[model samples]
Target: MEHRIRHLSTYSYDPAALRVALRLKLFPVDHEGQQVESWKVTVNDEEVSPLVFSDLGDREALWSSEDALDQLTITAEGIVSTRETNGIVRGMPGFAPPGIYIRETELTEPDEAIRALMGEATGDDTLSRLHALMGLIHERVKYLTGSTSARTTAADALKDGKGVCQDHAQLFIAAARTAEVPARYVTGYLQMEEETEELLETHAWAEAHVDGIGWVGFDPSHNLCPTERYVRLCSGLDAFGASPIRGNVLGETKESLEVSVAIGQSQQ
Candidate 1:
């Protein structure tokens, strides 16, 4: 499957004058099941600066404004071809050992509820158990937008019983780690066959390392493994680490952010 994607992020400053620095990981990963046809990143409507490669295999573009600016807009657009590999990530360069993913992050720290959820994943096979856990999470947490914020932790989302894809992925990672299965957070784009009022192009999912199969993606929010419709961007210990955009602002001024994303099947 092939997909065309467009993402626009705009930042507006209240004082209309502030210095800003940004790091972008908007580039898609080129791996065995995914191929990048064409991709580009632009800042303030111009081509991005030189890119620096990271150890996690993501290309980062750094941009800064020394002059007073009212707003900054970053746009990333590209076409990508993807294949369904049963959610298995293979033949990709490994950045960290599987055991490293078992370490807990602040957002994924497990509580009693998460520990109990991990215990409910009953199966002799690790793969099957993980699948069961995914189902459990889907049932436990209802998908409701605006029900949680970026600061929401796994335990908090579980207690609320409602959250978006990010919350689902975080809880899944926490539970998997509690079960001694190495898991990491993934950020990507999900192509929707038909646009809907509630549809979002950006998506989040969890990948757990199976003893025999390596890393496999599990989207508890959708209760399914990633398919060709998924375009993986990057992975990390948690959402904060895997965020597509990270930055800082100099000078004291209010900031407002707006993001728009579109992903659809490309015409041949």
Candidate 2:
């Protein structure tokens, strides 16, 4: 399916006397089952510097310079090609180290419960093992909106027995890692069953590295891999790694952010 995506992230400062820098991962790239037609990003404030390059993972680091700043806005729009390959990731150059995704971070870490949850070993079949893992996690954690925050870890979300899509994706990543599978977090857009004329903004999921399949996508939230209706942007170890948009500051101050997203289908 062909899709048109728009994402606008704006930040407002309480007092306009500080500097801001931004990192953007808002552009979509050609992936196993998806293609990017055209994408662009524009900044509202010239005070904020442009992005810089960094060799971290699949994503690029765009760093903004430190200068006097207040409010900042980053907007992105483009067309995306999406499909479902049943988690079959193909045509990737090389393999990412397992440790790069499993290391403990601010929002991702396998705790006692995660360890115990993943302790029940399964067979070696990649698809079957992933399916079993999905069942176990879905049964363990209930799906509820607004039950967890972006900072919530897999253990915490699992304990709460409910969380949003991000939490579900993170939990799946953590569980897959504990099971010795290399999984990464995905950020993208989802088309729900709403009758409204506007499309939703972004979505999250997990992709595991299978022996012969490379990377296979999985959405524990829906217990399925990404279909043609889903548009993928970027991925990382966790949300932090695949944040749609991020910023850094020289000094501390109060800030407010407002986001608006719209997705639509286009004539191919």
Candidate 3:
């Protein structure tokens, strides 16, 4: 499958600020399942700053504003071709050992409920057990757009029984960890077949390391593995760790953000 992706992020900050700096991990990962045909990033209508690939294999763009600007805008546009790999991430450079992903993060900390769910879904085979866990989470958590916030943790989402994709990914990560599976959070874009608008948004999923099979993507929100429709961006212990953008304001000022993304199948 081929896709056209466009992402726009606008930040409005009080001019009282001295400088603003940000690190962007918005570039899609280059792996066996996906190929980048053309990609570009820009800020305030200008080409992006120098890009550096992180040790983890994610492309990083260092963007900074030195002037007292009222707003900053960043845009990323690209065309990518992807193939279904049964959710297995292969041909990608490995950064850390699988055991590293087993470490718990604050957002993915499992509670009694998560442990119970993991136990009930556990099976002899790791792959089957993971699939069961994903289904269990999908069934338990209702997808409500505004039911949770960015700061909401997996435990909180599980308790409330309502959340968005981030919550589902986090909850799945937590449960997988409790079951002794090494899982990480993934952020990316999903080309929805029903979407007809020019403005879309990013998506989140989870990846677990299966012995002998490597890392496999699982999307509890859809109760399935990522396929050709999925385009991976980055991965970390949780949402915050894998955020597409991370930045700091140099002065005391208020800031507001707006993001728009559009993804659709393209004629090759």
Candidate 4:
């Protein structure tokens, strides 16, 4: 399948004065299952700098804020042709060996609740445990957008009973960690049907480590493994680590952001 994607981010500041700069990881990458047809990024202010190369996990860009500038706007547009695979990404470019991902992060630390959850399920199979965990999260939390923020914790989201896709993925990661399973966050895109709505923001999910197999993708949001309709970008401990974009700050006092994405399916 082929898809045309456009992602636009605009930042408006309450007070305008000096300069602005940012890092962007919005570019779709070329990999086994996907091909980048054409991609471009444009900043409204000509004074802004262009993107540079980085050896980080995913595509990145740097934007600098000089002086005391207030307003900032960023836009990204692209087209990509992608093919669906059999639910598995066989040869990921930089995947660490099987044992590495099991290392735990601060947020992913396991607790009693997680241990108990693990105990209830009597299977050593990582895939089975992963599916069970996904079901637990789906039942625990209701999907709602504004109830959670980027920093919401797994326990917090569970208690609040609401969060978006990111929260669901994070909660799942946290739970897996409690069970001594290594899980990471995945950032990517999803192609929707012609009548479907909501295609602007990037999508997120989780991956768990199996004893023999390396890292594998799971979308608790959809209760399935990633397929041809999904586009993979990067993976890390959580959203903060796998953020699509990051940047440095200058004298700018305050800023607001707007994001829009348009994804369309084309005849293969």
Candidate 5:
């Protein structure tokens, strides 16, 4: 699968905002399942270059303003070729053993309900248990756009039974980790088939480490594993940590953001 994707965001900060800065994880690395054909990130109108970590292969960049600014615009565009790996993630030039993912963040901390969910999952092994857990979460949560915020925790989403993909992923991760399975959050793009797939924005999902299979991607919101239509991005212990863009401002002010993502599939 070939995908040409562009993510554009404009931040309209109030005049009270004096300065701003951002950390970008916009670059994608070539891995066993995907190949980066072309990619770039721009702030306002200037292109910024990010460096890949020598030890981890994670790409990162920092953008800041030297003068006072009231508004900012950022754009990340790229083309990637992907292959269906049957949800099996491999050959990625990075390392953070599964133990690191098992460490829970505030957003993924499981409550009594989530822990009970762990007990409800019946499977022959770790992989099958995760699959059962995925199905359980998808059945429990209702996918509602704008129903939850960035700060919503897995417990909150599960109790409410409503949220976006972010909530689904976090809930799944929380439950998995509760069962002693290592899981993490993944943020990326999904190329939807208009007639068959739900059109979603800035996709988020979960990946769990299986004993014999390594890391496997799962989309509990969609009740399926990630396929060729998915483009893997950065991941972390939780949603907040895995965000593509993290920002900071110097003054007290209200911030309004407008975001747009355009994904075009090619018949190649």
Candidate 6:
């Protein structure tokens, strides 16, 4: 599938002051199952060029300005072609190591419930157990739109029994890690449905490092692996680490935010 995407994020300041700096992770790179055809990032209608990839193999850059303004907008637009690789991520390098994801973060700390969940993933082998775990999570948590925030942790989300994609992904990571399986958080874009025209946000999923097969993707909330309809963005120990954009504004009394996203398939 060939997908065209546009994402616009705006930050507004109440006092409207001095400076703004943004750390960006909006660029997507070509990998085994994904290819970036054309992409660009812009600030306030002006194009930004020469974004550098981080040491961890992420396309990242920093944008800053000193001019006082009411709002700052960052826009990323691109065309990408993707294919289904049986949920196996390949040909991507420099991610520290597969074992590193075994470590936990604040957002993915496993509690009693997650440990119990992991214990319930009964199977003859690792892969079977992961699939069983994903099924368990899917049945455990009910999907609720806008039911979670950035600070919501896996334990909290699991206990609450409701959340968005992030919650499901985090909970899966937490549960998988409890069994000593190497797992990580993944951020990306998902074409919700063939008839769906646009979306207001990106998607989240989790990846577990299987011994012989490498990293395999899983989405507990949706109960499926990422496919041709999904566009990979970045990965981290948790959602915070994999966030597409993080920023700070100096000299602003207060701040507000608005985001818009659109995704569509190319006719040609």
Q: What clash count goes with each model?
A: 0, 7, 1, 12, 0, 0
Point out the worst 10-residue segment of candidate 1 by lDDT.
192-201
lDDT of 2 at 256: 85
Q: Relative to the true structure, how large is the alpha-carbon lDDT of every model?
A: 0.88, 0.73, 0.88, 0.69, 0.87, 0.87
What is the C-alpha local distance difference test score of candidate 5? 0.87
What digit string (tens of lDDT, one per residue) describes model 6 on residues 1-268? Answer: 9999998888888898578878888888778999999999998887876477765558888888868878888899989999999888888856567777899999999999999999999999999999999999999888999888999999999999999999999999999999889999988888878565776688899999999998899999889888888898888899999998888778836988898888889777
Residue 263 lDDT in model 1?
80
TM-scores across all candidates? 0.95, 0.86, 0.95, 0.84, 0.95, 0.96
Off by over 4 Å in 5: 52-57, 195-200
- Model 1 per-residue lDDT tens digits across residues 162-210: 9999999999999999988999999998876556222354799999999
TM-score of 5: 0.95
Q: For candidate 1, what is the lDDT?
A: 0.88
For candidate 2, the TM-score is: 0.86
4 or 6: which has the higher lDDT? Answer: 6
Q: Any idea what lDDT model 2 has? A: 0.73
RMSD of 3: 1.5
Ranking by lDDT: 3, 1, 6, 5, 2, 4
The candidate that wins on lDDT is: 3
Give the CA lDDT, 0 to 100, for residue 220 in model 4.
Answer: 71
User: Candidate 4, residues 93-150: lDDT per residue as tens digits?
Assistant: 4545544556666555555665665566455587777877777777767888678888
Model 1 CA deviation exceeding 4 Å by range: 196-201
Better of 2 and 4 by lDDT: 2
Deviation in Å, model 6, residue 112 alpha carbon: 1.0
